[model samples]
Target: MRNDPLLSIKGLRVEFPTQDGPLVAVNNVDLDVARGEVLGIVGESGSGKTVLGLSAMGLIDRPGRLTAGQVVFDGQDVTKYSESGWRNIRGNRIAMIFQDPTTSLNPVQQIGAQMIEALQSHRDISRDNARQIIRNAMVRVGINSPDERLNAYPHQFSGGMRQRVVIAIALLNEPDLIIADEPTTALDVTIQAQILRDMRRLSRDTRTSLVWVTHDLGVVAQIAQRVAVMYAGRIVENGPTEKILKSPCHPYTEGLIASMPANALPGERLHSIPGGLPQLSKLPAGCSFAPRCNYAASACNMSPKLIQISSDHAVRCVSPLDGGS
Candidate 1:
């Protein structure tokens, strides 16, 4: 049986005010996270992956706002929620684990104190109960000697351990949705694998939906069952993980796949996508990717909306690749 998605984000446009004009950081996009699944948002830096994730959680900072579209969670349209309403939803029903755990965590406070506060912020629970929950969560995330660790400040833990603690904090409420932006970026490869595995197992055990935002295709590929490839504030392609990675249609998606070392031959010089990312303020009139696409044509000058390439795959390019080099 098909499971209804717990979150549906449609036409999500994010804009920031500039001296010249408004800048679209996250163009019109659509995304969904079922009751139990990890949706991967993959792209290079400045590709709108993190921006879109932030928009979903209604945490856009100053000068930036969710200008257009809807952020619907659990069958309700959250976009209309007042600031206080949104605040109530944040960190209780939906939480985010930002890229830099060090910065996301409070520096001066001990881990236990911050974690207890996070729990109490959402639930009307006692400090001792919150501490017990924190300990259980710490052990759940593989932290040893929960009591000793809880007393330690955020700076005391290694990068990996800190990240895990951040993950535990996010999971404290057993939220239906968790947005993890580059959670594994600071860790070594082995540690990255272990953390990703832990996230996968925990998601299954807890029935929480996850949106993993990262530039590492390898990490997303490892944990996400569905993939969304974004570039220049738009989603260029999205589909099942196997189909999108093995048979990417959009030129940008193809370029990202081609750049992966796994696809390169031994002793071969690495291939990078041609051309630099266009300035967001000076975005082109035609296809945003036309500057780098090798197969550009006059028809490509027209803006293209995401069109289905297969039963479950979609591409935004007028002329997508035909599964070949």
Candidate 2:
């Protein structure tokens, strides 16, 4: 971890009021993203990855409250920020690229106009200057003939091009941090690769921190410097991407890696973890993953806390696969 992280999340908890009860979408989670670092958050659907990202952006809406914890960005605790305060920080200091580009873009507005509006919204710039910036940003994302393309509406662009426009808009203000919530999941493999490469390059060039949320470990391996494996609203393991991929400590992390298609042998069946995620309101007494863990023991019945296994690696397990006890 860096001495001064760009974003720090401590004991964060997000809950939603449901008919049954208050469902804890994000359990007590702590994370840090250093400047120019790419931290990948990996988990199954409903594992609270998206909620965690939204919490970082201060975007949790009505009924879904940030019940606990502090989200510190650049040493300032933003949980205390009001809506107006968040407005200044949102597009100006931090930006988010969501999963769907269509929903993020305005169908009726020209792409150039939208991009120019995004830039001018955060910065006091002239229309001509903003348009130039938009054109440069579009070209940076590999959008050809940016000047001509700018006049086209979102519907006129292909799925990949729309996503590129979204990325361009997110980077227009040059925010310090970017939270991408599976932004490439909807694209084809080729498009996904291009986007990932561009994002990684952009982060490195700008020294901007990134938190990428996705269910695909392959994506994490390609782009993330560090990996956090989340399960049942908690981080089961976190460490350098190479270490997490090569020597996963948590059973859930191991299972996730094993289930990857790249790890499967030709003609052999793909591996899968048994059982599904537990209901947050009705989680087991101890570890949430104990029910599905093949190595689960009686000790697992007692909830475990995240413990350091090395200088950087951490895992929440009674018996970590790394031989920790």
Candidate 3:
């Protein structure tokens, strides 16, 4: 992996303006993705993994604008750029694939049309050239009878096929960064594995950095070079995947590992973390994870910074090494 980061986010805060007050979905988040690296952001449903991914691409719009922080992409502060600057980078330099392809794909248009549009929108290639490129992309994604599938609508394809098309669209430009939000959630177990493998292999071959946003730790272990555990909108712990999964330091991280259905402990009782995520409208003052953190102490009441546990790892809570929830 490259020592210099491709994307860097610092003090990033995203809030939704409401009648009562502002609702903070993502708060005080800081992360970095290096070139040719896969950084997995793992968390429960409401922990803001999806929101954080969207914000990274400067995709937050309208009432849910970024409150504070800067997104440094290759040394440039993308957060400070006007609307046009973001337009230039999005889909061209950085591409994103969402969980539901149906939601992002056009139902009226054929698969070929959508992919061709994506190519032409970002590149100066002619329609004929773009069509050829799209076919090659379909073939690269393991699609058989690529020519026939090209004319089919989104509804005509299986869930896995649609996702592969979505991925192909994202890869059409060979972007430097790709952020996938639950890209495998809609597929079956077998199909999920295939897509995951294709994604990892393609990313490595192309030397593209990826941010895989998902609640699935198993997927993280399978494809990510590093993992960041998020809770209540903040990353509780982050480090190399092998190190963090093998020996988690944060309470939240520990619970997630113990509760993994894909790789549960042998002959050990499976334990789930108590309490659900807190309401965004009324967040806890200190560490947002305190209510569910078994290691909560008096110091936890005063918000803790991300403390370094080792050279490559950092945990948000004051005494994260004490453990468990």
Best by the lDDT measure: 2
Q: Which ten residues in a row have the lowest lDDT in candidate 3?
A: 316-325
Q: Provide the lDDT at 128 for model 1.
A: 84
In candidate 1, residue 9 scores what lDDT? 89
Deviation from native of the Cα of residue 287 in model 1, angstroms: 1.2
- Indicate whether candidate 2 or candidate 3 has the larger TM-score: 2
Higher-ranked by TM-score: 1 or 3: 1
Residue-by-residue lDDT tens digits, candidate 3, 1-325: 4577899999999999887698887889889999999999999888889899999888888889898998999889998888888878888789999999889999999999998888887779998899888888888888988899989999999899999999998988888999999999888999999999999999889998999998888889999999999988888899999989888888888888877765566877678788888988788899888898887888888988999878889998787774322
Residue lDDT tens for model 2, 78-135: 9999999999989779999999999999999998888888887778999999988888
What TM-score, computed on C-alpha atoms, does each candidate reach?
0.96, 0.97, 0.94
Candidate 2: global Cα-lDDT?
0.92
Task: Point out where model 3 deviates above 4 Å.
Answer: 262-269, 322-325
- Candidate 1 per-residue lDDT, tens place, 1-325, comes to 3477899989989988888788888999988888888999998888888889888788888879887899899889998888898888888899999888999999999999889888888899998888888888988889989999988998889999999999999989888899999989988998888898899998889878899999988887789999999989999998998888877888888888778888899789877888899877778987899989988999988998899888778889888888544
RMSD of each: 1.5, 1.7, 2.1
Where is model 2 more than 4 Å wrong at Cα?
A: 1-3, 323-325
